[model samples]
Target: MANMYDHAYDLEKAIRESEEFKGLKAAYDTVMNDPSSKEMFENFRNIQLELQQKQMQGQEISEEEVQKAQSVVQVVQQDEQIAKLMEQEQRLNIAINDISRIITKPLEELYGQPEE
Candidate 1:
């Protein structure tokens, strides 16, 4: 029988070779290859990380900060290359989330599904 860790490594290899991961990598390369797009993407990512950090620390996000984040989101969404990268990222995230759910099914079965 295959060891669990070996199966996990196999899954990791499979994910790396998956088309969704390839598309994400290509889109990321396209964004990073252009200076303006790369700067914009980096700024957007920074804002997202900042907000996430604040939330994790139980800090309240200010209205101005929210507006700034929204503005950054709009700018990134308008950039064709960044937009494509985001789309590819979303596809990969969905695939990863699905795999996570599948892998956690045994725990769910043991503990039973939580109430909605």
Candidate 2:
């Protein structure tokens, strides 16, 4: 089995290679570091990244990949004291997984559910 960090790294690579996430990150960083909007930047970037992850999941990427990429987001946004981002990330992780499972309901029933 892969360690979580290794899994996370792979996910990071996946996200870094994704054009959509990259564009969002560039916009997010701009929104964050701009002196004029520093206060709102963290909140907005967090939400945007959260939405990006959801978008990735809905596009048929692995749920685990989006979630792992999100944890890495914490390290990226730390200077903003936006530790709340970590909590939000975790919650979104759950939401994305739930959504993925919901989308696969037919397959799950056909193949039988895997052990949680």
User: Evaluated with lDDT, which candidate comes out highest?
Assistant: 1
Q: Write the per-residue lDDT of candidate 1 for residues 29-109, one digit (tens) a residue.
A: 999999999999998998999999999999999999999999989978999999999999999999999999999999989
**Please, what is the TM-score per model?**
0.94, 0.32
The C-alpha lDDT values of all candidates are 0.96, 0.60
Q: What are the per-model numbers of colliding residue pairs?
A: 0, 0
| RMSD of each candidate relative to the true structure | 2.3, 14.9
**Candidate 2 lDDT tens digits, 27-47:** 556545666445644545666
**Cα distance off (Å), candidate 2, residue 113:** 7.9
| Top of the candidates by TM-score | 1
For candidate 2, what is the lDDT?
0.60
